[model samples]
Target: MQATRVLLELAGNVVLLLWGLHMVQSGLTRALGGDLRRILGAGLRNRWTAFLSGMGITMLLQSSTATGLMATGFTANGLVSLMPALAVMLGANVGSTLIVQVLAFDVTHVAPVLLLGGFLAFRRGGRTRSRDLGRVAIGLGLMLLSLHLLVATIAPAENAPMLRRMLGMLTADPVVAVLLAAILSWAAHSSVAAILLIASLAGGGVIGPEAAVAMVAGANLGSAINPIVEGPGGDGHNPAARRLPVGNLVNRIAGCLIVLPLLGPITAGLQTLSPDATRLAANFHLAFNLAMAALFIGPLPWFARVLTRLFPERVAVADPGMPLYLDRSALRVPHLAIANAAREALRMADAVDSMLRGALDVLHSDDRKRVQEIRRMDDVLDRLHDAIKHYLTQINVEDLDERDARRVSDVLTFTINLEHVGDIVDRNLMEAASKKIRRKLRFSTEGAAEIAGMLERLSETQRLAAAVFVSGDIRSARALMREKEVIRDLETSATEAHFARLRAGRTESVETSALHLDILRDLRRINAHLVAAAYPVLDQSGELLPSRLKHGATHG
Candidate 1:
């Protein structure tokens, strides 16, 4: 009964620790997610800048795991090079230990005040920012309260015979002690919590100095495990995001290993700094991570090169839509301006088609960097959209003949379709890709092939539509309009096929149902945009219908 009671009390405290960490993570995310990402983005210009950025953000977030995940996303997006990103992660490790240093001090007196103030602010807050701040305060209070509870619970264990024997066994085998602490920290998903438990145990005389030091080493290594295991790299969440956490884990493990054999000296050194066992553990945690950052800061480039070889960039289809023909000086001449707009419109078409061709690659590949690189090309489409819009607006319609006036209208309509195609690709299609990569999802082979076939047809039809936009070719315009129907039918067929696969108990189909349908729908949208580009040329030629049915036609 006593053992059961003690176990339950320890479990409850651990849960409280996790709950507090969750509150803090979510609260800060809501308040500063975008701004922090932007900061990290701007700071990745070099190793020094990236390291400082990592340190500053982790200090604010108080979680190296969170910073590592964010940096992974940036690397996946090609915003940060591997070397600088690795440097940022080094600083984040030091920053994470700072939380332990702060939490080790006696702060339970403020828990009640923080809880009350946070609850009121959260309840009465108008802005989302205020509410998020309230959540942070609440998290802080819970953490302090949990710590106080832990200390109280462990105090009674000092005189317990069974507890002392267990502590003695751990003290006898420092490696076992280290491994147990690592497991405890990994399970808790917060090294701070694990360290706090060790500190509390040590302060109560349930653990000695050497045992505490070994456990701290394990706890440090264990902290690295949470991000690596939970991070996108291991779960297939995203290979691009995996590098930061994996590199971090390697660094932590190396540091822990180097210090593990020398626990006696390290503990003695720490004892000189602080006689209190809790403060020693906290000081050791901070000092070890600081040493890691210092040791690896200069060699970050070499470390990055090692990770790059381990997680090399996947081969992706080269994007072929660079708009070199968009001459700014040509805009003053109406004819040259129209010609430039047409050329830019063709570039947009090429981009849309290139994105469509890569759609299947997004579905089947394990390479997250490749997936993000493809998505990043959509920025070019936005630039082309703006350039074409401005260039077309500069043309004088009054100076154009009736034929050329109609061409201007056709070109403008074509540019809008081009822009829509880019949006669907970047927003809809890429979002689905990110979801799949993040979730480690895949489509069934048959379903994947079905979507692939439709995208290819759409890409060809889009190319023809682009040609028709510039040449005003009636036959090609008619063909594009017809292919629009093909895409619509393909979407319907894929939807039905997906359901059939789901009914047959296909795991891939069930897992990727949302992804498959979304990609199909997005392709149909792209086809619609391409088809619309054909309408103006067809209408001017007297070959376009207002709808599928004539005015007097009867419904089936």
Candidate 2:
């Protein structure tokens, strides 16, 4: 009965620890919102900045895996370069050591105070900042409290014959102990959890400093698995997608090779400096990570080069069915996922613009070959549109902050407009192509030149609009809105002129005149959607409402 009660208590403590950690992570993510991404992005401009950003983010969130995953996403999306990401990962290793340092201190007397303060803040505070603070406090308290309970429960058990025998078995084979620690850390998806378990065992004298040190080394290696598991998996052929797992595995393996041999000397040195066994173990873990980081920092550029060589960039087959940027593995970090979604949306916009350009080319030239090519490209654009919409829907299910929610909505809206733009181009240009092929309809030289000039303007505007959206340039975005007025006036004048030619019998056939009118309508529609794609950027830059663009007024 006593043993059963102890087991139950241990189980409860474990549950509390997991729950507290979850609350803390969620609260911090919500409180930081887009600021987290902006800070990390800005700080990654230089090596030192990247290192500091990585350390700061990991320490605040209490998870190196989270920090590494975000950096991987940034690297994959072309937001941050490879060297900066490596720098951040190195910094994350250093920051994680801080957790072990905190655990090493005897804070049992202060645990209850933190717990009380956290509970009070959670119950009485209304703001996001206050609630997030409460979560942080409660999480720290629970971590410390759980550690206290773990020590009490296991310390007495250390004297039992069965427990002693188990300890002897682990210590008897240090390789097996290291493997066991690696598996445990991987299973938990948390190095801190694994380290804390080792610390508890060591504090109870069930595991000696040597065995504990081996486990610590293994824990560092094991923690890399989380990033691998969270990387792009559905289509493994992508070079960037494949690099996620490869880079994580290589870094961890290299770290293990450098650290394992030094463990004995490091632990012994720590023992000599700090007689307290628990503090000694904690210091050893910190020293190992820091030393490993220093050793690898110089070689990281070579490592990245090796990765690039091993995974040479392959020309991806154009499959409309395949998504260009939407990878579910990104959902693990919501901000990065949103960023990926935005990138995919930009690609979708580009596809639509390309289709519109193709359509305009066919309509002006009446070329059968160009018509067929445009139809093929439109089919591709349609496939990409469906993929992006489905991807965004999946992302919407995860918990998102207000800013991310708004961004998702904006992406969805932009995708819809882009799809409509593609449809307009396809229907109008294809119809014109059919008439020209069947009847050999020909326009006057002046009429052909006028339409070609209009097509050029449309093509230029589409290209600029795509650039503005992708670059997130408010100046270019607002300029796109302004250009819409010009496109509208040109479209109206061109259509009226074509109609005048038809009424005066200057054009060849009535069908040709109808096709010309439809082509003008399609150009106008494409421009409107391009303006729509730029709306979010203008809004983000604190510009006027989209209604102003539609109404051609500054109605602020």
The number of the candidate with the highest TM-score is 2
Give the lowest summed-lDDT range of ten residues in model 1. 547-556
Model 2 regions lying over 4 Å from their true place: 1-12, 22-53, 73-84, 108-172, 205-209, 232-234, 238-251, 254-277, 298-309, 315-329, 393-399, 443-499, 506-509, 534-556
lDDT string for model 2 (322-437, tens) is: 66567676675666677777777777766766666676567566688777777776677678777777776776443565566777787778777777777776777676777777
Following a full C-alpha superposition, what root-mean-square deviation does model 1 have from the true structure? Answer: 19.7
Can you write out model 1's per-residue Cα lDDT over 216-310, one digit (the tens) per residue?
Answer: 88888898887666544443233555677788889888887888788889989999999999899889888988899898889988888888888
**lDDT for model 2:** 0.73
Top-lDDT structure, candidate number: 1
Give me the runs in candidate 1 sitting further than 4 Å from their true place. 234-241, 316-556
Score each candidate by Cα lDDT.
0.78, 0.73
User: How does residue 174 of candidate 2 score in lDDT?
Assistant: 61
Write down the TM-score for model 2.
0.80
